[model samples]
Target: MSAKTIMIQGTASHVGKSVLVAALCRIFKQDGYRVAPFKSQNMALNSFVTRDGGEMGRAQVVQAEAAGLEPSVDMNPILLKPTGHASSQVVVLGKPVGNLSAMGYHTDYAPKALAIIEGALNRLLAANDMVVIEGAGSPAEVNLQEHEIVNMRIARMAQAPVLLVADIDKGGALASVVGTLELIAPDDRARVRGIIINKFRGDISLFQPAVKFLEEKTGKPVIGVVPYFQGFRVQEEDTIPEDRSRAELVEEQGWVDIAVVNLPHISNFTDFDPLEDEPDVRLRYVSKGSNLDEPDLIILPGSKNTIGDLAFLNRSGLAAQIVEFYRRGTPVIGICGGFQMLGRELNDPLHTESEIPRLDGLGLLDTSTTFAPEKITTQVEAEVAGSGLFLCETSDNRINGYEIHMGRTELAPDVRPAFTILVRSGEKVFFPDGAVSPDGLVFGTYIHGIFDSDSFRRRLINTLRRRKGLEPLQASDTLLVHEQRERDFDKLAAVVRSSLAMEKIYGLLGMEGPICHG
Candidate 1:
């Protein structure tokens, strides 16, 4: 019941802290330990709903999967979802408290949040053999140290050894590490047992000198210099890396082409990670002002701000382009906020999302949505109830995914329901979700991660293939995305274990003996 713990603290945001924690979680699990991933607080737009209908960051969800455990809100007690420039919707233990300004959160919420974090940490420690804690931003932010609930605060509370990580690819890796160590308090600095240089792209031999410099500068062992990795696909914790440039979105060779409209406040884009991994689909993320290409399918992805982003689509002319694509027989599917946008109108009387009281939707589906204070965050099992392009082969229309939204949609009598909700948050339920046009061309659903359902995803792509005069692909060699993710966990663990000083890691965890994996 007494769990050994290690914390991965990064020099700054997006320095690969989340990925490193995931790798260690997998390594510990492979070493025959009951490992769990924990973060006292997480600030991210990409989120996942647990079975109990509690919402938490997807990074912890990935780490939980790597540790071979189901995600729980206790793994992440506090979640900060940014709603605007100065405000965030604070969620404690997987439920929303309110949208509070940064100052208000520090003054009113931090004291109470620390207790919640302590309770969650104790629960995880009691249940697991080991727990991997991840820090947010920098512990060196002196201005927020008094109110900080993540980073050194949690590390000290958990009495965990800290592995300070720096992104060598960002230049001045040594400086960042030294500067961080200098800024944090002496006791917090003492907690840092080692240093890790992440995202090193160049020759490893050339970087050896700098690693030595960091170790000498901070008096901490340079645990590893992880080279920039590829091939294995995992979810990026927060926003897409700005430097992660892609080639032209149109590959011009795939049977079923899909272009996802990337909105300004895009959330849960990980929903399409499965589609991007599929060899048969040529997927692209089309930005708001980017030139549109005629693809077989156009997807309106989930947005954090339904009213605000819909206004952006209309003002930016992407809405017109989407209508044109739909008119020319290109199929369209909207998800979450996107689904709300496809409706006839959206009303926000309570200002739950934004100041706009009402805004006109794309009118693709004969439905209307109204924003409510009650946000629905639940996992669902649904079956296709209406005939549509994606539902052409209805022999197997059962699909499961999670929903996180605040609006409720009501379909018109003429439009058919898209899906029938069979189960919600692990309970029996009967309700209609989304709507389909009479012609069965355009449809919208609030379900995120719907494409993760292998059979349903394959059917969608195979139907597109038939429409394009290509033969329907048989589902003989279908592999579930979750299975592939398990393989990825092992692949990542192997890479990191080879790069890092795993023996020292075990020593730091107060354990010994090299474990073998089959």
Candidate 2:
């Protein structure tokens, strides 16, 4: 039998579609159903490498974790990582096809992409007991409706009942719901089963008349009014609001201050989530060179366009600040594209990332990088190569992270290797990964999740504290990072269950009542 399916589409982008899908996935899995999440197309720089070496959006990875399943490329079939303002690098089935302009993708590639989407959807439906589908942006883009492959098109293909979600925190929640329903075609509008008011801040009791007005006007029930939740943690998918003012650089005071140089096309900023969880760390993203304050550490994050972002660093004067920080004995670390930028030179012979043939780097590491056509996407396990560094207390320390980059870095003869990767893509391998300067003040690596390990994080922080003549801190008593993630899933599921009308939702899925409160 085909699996039951439900689609959640937002009235606008960042309307809580990803979080709601994750909540439902957790709820269903707790109730003893094999659930999976699917998104036909995703456009973001945040991505993940599956166990089988396939690449997909990180949001689906979070949802898959909530569902107690391994992430699969079929969960996110098409990924569009923007390389330029007008063009994007398209990945179909976990590999890069090529870069295409927006017009070219819509005009020439939409049909083929639609076919790929349907094939993946069918396979997912056959395997799972239930599938929670999330839509991108909005379905009310009437101008792009004919070429739409993500929203209403997938809903019709799966025959899934739709729950339109609107953020009440943003004003015009009622108008957005009414406007979206009015814009879609009559038949497409009929598929919407109910409306969910998400991210509500004020007292819900005061909103009863508003909910009643919406129901009377649109003839659809307000199925839920989810309050604004602050502590719930989930991997966000390129939805960070741009209007919020950038944080000001502040004194460390009692905590270790960390500054991450915000690149032009910053990818995988979620790499710093673990640091945010640490109580003694104050992490901030600084975009301007003048904003670089004296901090315990400075990190150069991954970027979608390395050469372009490197040029941005040069033009914005942030490169000079980074060099000054290194000269002053402050620890500076780089990952992936950031690792490439820390080297002596970056060469793009075939214009893989940019038209620039060669560009000078920050000159912090004795290494050079060259862009290649093939991108590496794999999981890895590595051991610290030596002691007396930020990431390792002993040479036996093991760290796990994933590699996602297109450049091949070559180290100088005199530089010391940082970590020796023992496994790649679930296979045994022995190879050096990164470089460390002689002074131990600068390093660069391709690993993304190196800080998630408690032992490594504690050692690094305590080492910095000792440098400042401060006492060492106690190791975290909280759960391990992965276990904390599981608990967070349960917390989100509880909030969703209490707020949403599950009886109506189950009825729409053709399931009988006495819904399991999992």
Candidate 3:
């Protein structure tokens, strides 16, 4: 049988494009079809490690989950991680090779990117019954459309049928549907087989007239309309713009509010996810123009471009605000890039020409960070260095995490000591490489994912609660909530699998008949 591919192009980003593609992958997989999820390229810091030690966007990982398969680097060939507007760290099949500007990638590497896309597609075709491809941001971003490697070109190369997805929740999604069709080249427009309206809230039937009008105008079928599912916890793809209405922030049960400095190009912002699951702790992402509002703790998060973000923080006046927060006895914590920013100065002479012209840091920690060419990437297990912030009264707990950064920090004089660098990389290498300040108020390390441990989370929340005069949370309740959410996500999959037209979906995906349910 010939390979039949389905491409899901979004009218805009964060529409239910990823989820819809995932649902389709699951539906076909249950019908006894081997399916794979493909994205020609992705720009996200929310990434996942494949079994082969390669990394790709986490959205692909979730889609792989829906298909009951493990994630592989081949599923996403090109990954563009924006370190700054002018430059991005480019990864080919999950390895950081070099950095390039957006224009440089488009002009110099478009042909090569095409080859990579084709190579990934060829493998998918040979191995799977169908390949479901997810597209990037808006299809109509005119400035970014030329020599495109992701959405349209990949579709054309694979000779796949396209299903345009619009986020009806974003409002004017109908307009997005029409606008996308109008913007594409005539030949490209012909490839669209249908459209899917996704993430509609309340009474989907209310939009029947709007749906009919769009179908009549574009002459493409509306395959399905998916409603919003609340409890589904698909891994996020990027730093979803920090909004006030985030559930994690509002529903936080932690008595202490932890403020994270939102940098311009925040890396691995999802480091806060495990912490979000704790009912007691509220994680606040504080960006420029936002007030500190007296947070119990101030955390400096990782940054893709540290020096650039430092300058941005200074420009936004948040840097001064942070200094003030430190003076006011607020506990300050820095992680990775945030840790670098807490130093007296950051030296990047290799990339920048300036020397000795120090960018003022928070000065909470007596340290200086020097940026180097090399990046560190690997999983690590560590014991609490000295007494960590959360478990000051208690002893070390096993912390499993990873490190991804480029810098060396040397502690300055007169700062209180926090963690003593203990075992690293399976060796008893202690106190030589990394350390926290003495007071424990200013703490940091190059480690990312430092809070993946459930014990660490509970201790942090319990510490915050005790400080705020609140009772400790029951462990059973938290476990029950997460279990219920997973059950809900499973039901969500069943809903999508049963609602869409099965025969047509199987035919579109080049799959045999569905198995008998009875």
After superposition on all C-alphas, the RMSD of every candidate to the true structure, in Å, is 2.1, 2.5, 3.8
Candidate 2 lDDT over residue span 1-518, tens digit each: 39999999999999999999999999888877889999999999999888888888989998999999999999999999999888989999888899999999987897789989999999999999889999999899988898989999999999999999999888899999999999999998899989999999977899999999999998888889988886658778885323222233123524577888888789988888777666666677888644887988999999999999999999998899889878888899898999999999999999998878999999989899999999999999998874345755474489998999999999999888888899999899999998888878888889888888777877787787787776667775322678778989999999998999988988999987443445
lDDT of each: 0.88, 0.87, 0.73
Segments of candidate 3 deviating more than 4 angstroms: 1-4, 25-34, 48-53, 124-129, 140-146, 239-254, 352-358, 391-396, 411-434, 479-488, 513-518
**Tens-digit per-residue lDDT, 1-518, candidate 3:** 24578898989888877777777777666666778999989888666555455667777877887777878788888887777656778878777888887788888976677877788778878888778888888777887788678888888888888889888887998889999999998888898888888877887778899889998999988887877766545556774534434445334453567788888777777777666555555568888888889787888888877888888888999888888877776777778888888877888877731223457676767788887777665456666654545536455466656666768777756543344445544556554334466656567767666766666667766766676777777666453333543454466678776555556656665656665431
Ranking, lDDT, top scorer first: 1, 2, 3
Candidate achieving higher TM-score, 2 or 3: 2
The window of 10 residues in a row where model 3 has the poorest summed lDDT is: 479-488
Task: Give the per-residue lDDT of model 1 (tens digit) for 1-518.
Answer: 39999999999998999999999999888888889999998999899999999999999999999998999999999999888787889999999988999999987888788888999999999999989999999999989999999999899899999999999787878889999999999999999999999988978998778778877888999999898888777688986533222343334433577888888788898998887776666777888667777688999988878899999999999999999888889889999998999999999999998889999999999999999998899999999887867765467778998999999999888888888899997889998988888878898998888899898888888878888887666666444798889889899999999999988988898999346574
* Distance from true location, Cα of 391 in model 2, Å: 3.9
TM-scores for the candidates: 0.96, 0.95, 0.86
